[model samples]
Target: MGAHQITIVDMDIVETSNLHRQALYTEDDALNMVPKVHAIKEHIARINHHVDVQTYYQEITSNNIEDILDEVKPDIVIDGMDHFKIRYLINEVCHKHQIPWVYGAAVGNKGTVYGIDFKGPCLKCLLKQMPSSGESCAINGVLPTIITQVASYEVAEVLRYLSGEGFSKKLITIDTWHIDFKAMNVDILKNHACEICANQHYSLLETKHQQHIESLCGRTYLFRYQSSIFEHAHHLPGEIVKSTSFAKLIKDDDYEITLFKDGRMNVYGIEDDEEAFKLYHSYLKALK
Candidate 1:
């Protein structure tokens, strides 16, 4: 498949642990501590100079999803998103825009893939109740086989949908460790009247549910839904690397860390929120 342009967006930087499953990243990238979007963009550019590559060094949240999608205006959006909240945001925005997107997720050698054609069986059907803290590839661990398998299948579906060939509406689940593949039908779309699929309602776009602290213009991207655990800047348990009225930056061997007094953190130098949260919790424990 030949595409004129591709836009890659992510809020985190490359990490050592991600190399096993995140196929596009390399050891050098992790060591260099480059942002994931930047590293991927450079890699793609080097591989194919003809294809235009664009990257957004920011997380895809409900607030920014619509704007990003509108700006990119891609033929189809691929679901490289890590968790359900953002994925659900993607589903809602894509369907609302009448755009098609593939939904994919993998953890513990198991991978799931399905196409949302803006037609039937959107993600909301499968996930009636979103977990407060969902299972992620980071927490449960993942094998490269499953990640690539699901990604490749998602690409195939994208191509099929773009080529007028269409894609299977059935939910495709793969157990790569066991070498088992199942394409089973999910009846949630048939049974439940999904507000997303039935009515053209995407409330996530307007909702400001995620706890965000924006003091600086563009220095960091921080999104933590939890309430504050620390009250004041002086109460910061971690040895303060630098302190300011607006925020406090900390030192971490792995992460370029920034923590607010209210317990909000903006962790740079690592890819994905899981690792950032891990560091954040460890610091909290150390303080205790």
Candidate 2:
């Protein structure tokens, strides 16, 4: 715990939305469209020159999880993701290797944190089954204060675990808006028939998650997806609402669309997937 290394893995770039909760970036970073991992690495270096920080500007997919874990060899992993698909993957991988990890999540004014180690309850213990559908942070929205609180709790657990001190194995829930804090007992959950921890069956580790990539087979996905519009002159269409290295967003009253440099696109304003594909196809045809 005295001298340690940190590995930050995230494929996303800094945006106006991230500046609020994630203290690692600034408005300048959001405006300039800096990669999240790269920007945070710089920030950490400035704060502590001694700390060895490794950054991966890539997504946490099943394909590369093993390689990344092998290369970094972290003492403990932190759960910063909001998605469940990846959360389960992390739980399985960490549990399989007897590694400790802190799982934390924040949404709106509410947040939750739980310490997961080989002896403690794994994520599967909390939610016996994989949830069908979820409301993403993108849709539900999250408060910056809530995020900070959740992250702080997660860091505290990490410190405790590393120092060989007893950590809270219970689920810690907090609501910053209401100033409510509660530690829910997870004894029953932990003792339950958790296929993951009980049987040591890490299903996620054995199976390959099908990646639905829109990019062509030969084309490489951009490590840093930033739009030149963030720092360069642009002749793009629409209002040019948001620009990232990977894609340029153009939105108007009628249409909200994002066009990727890899020839992938999505139309969110429209409900129909076919219609969105058609719109992207027509736009591509026009470009040609």
Candidate 3:
């Protein structure tokens, strides 16, 4: 609703490992940065002086979500995150409050961007299930050009919508490998049974799903242990592998731990959820 001031709520950070696909970052860019929100805010300020920006270096968990939304009170929200969990939360928040937000994703040479208006179908309408467990840019590999292209398209749509220009409620897909682009018009395919929008259910904002830390999409996770556990983490016997400056990947025989500064973990090569929990506890004990 406002002119140019937009608040960006992101919990991740700039990392050396992400430089390839993170076109906006350099090793020194995140040398001492603790959160992604801060890094992105600074980057935007440096490049686009016409935009008003604020950064929240905290996760959009159930507990602090309402408070952050209220604090930022953004006229428009943007999806700078790779994870879908928080996007779900944003959808619910925007729809309930009548705010609009944009969604974007890039992997390898491909990506997609879409805008969610308050009056139509939301993210849930595009898919029939939850995100499957798998690899990410950290697990797989992404090029800088693709990520930049995706974010550029996302911002383009944001600018258009914010400036009284409306975008198609359809899905926009692009494949940079072949330079192919297509916009699928689906404005009439909105679902009346969407659990988040149509149901008026704000379950994600209720505080139950919020974990101490969370792994976003892209085979990345954060291991946020209690402050008391910091010193103990040194006792663990293996090198903690990390993405440039974005995420830490710690692995051993039975498992791999992808941890972020936000205190979340993405456990891979393990089938059992209980085992994931056990691994989490094992790492927690070491950190303690």
In candidate 1, what are the lDDT values of residues 1-288, reduced to their tens digit? 667888898766676968876878899877656778888888888899888889887656777887888888878888986667778888888888888889998877899999887777788888877644334533666787888999989988888898998777778999998999998765445424787887767788779665543321122335342335444434444456655433455664655565544455665555545655665556556545
Clashes per candidate (backbone, < 3 Å) = 1, 7, 19
1 or 3: which has the higher TM-score?
Answer: 3
What lDDT score belongs to each candidate, Candidate 1 first? Answer: 0.71, 0.71, 0.68
Off by over 4 Å in 3: 1-4, 30-34, 48-52, 135-140, 211-221, 235-275
TM-score of each: 0.76, 0.78, 0.79
Please write out the lDDT profile of model 3 over residues 1-288, one tens digit for every residue. Answer: 334676767656565666666655667765643466667667877988788777676666767777887887776777876667767877878888888888897777788899888887788887646575333555566666777788878878887886887766668888888889998886766888888778887777665644643444443344456544333334654666544344555677766655554555555565554555666677776665
lDDT of 3 at 94: 84
lDDT of 1: 0.71
Q: Which ten residues in a row have the lowest lDDT in candidate 2?
A: 216-225
What's the CA RMSD for each of the models?
7.4, 5.9, 4.2
Q: Tell me the deviation in Å of residue 63 in model 3.
A: 1.8
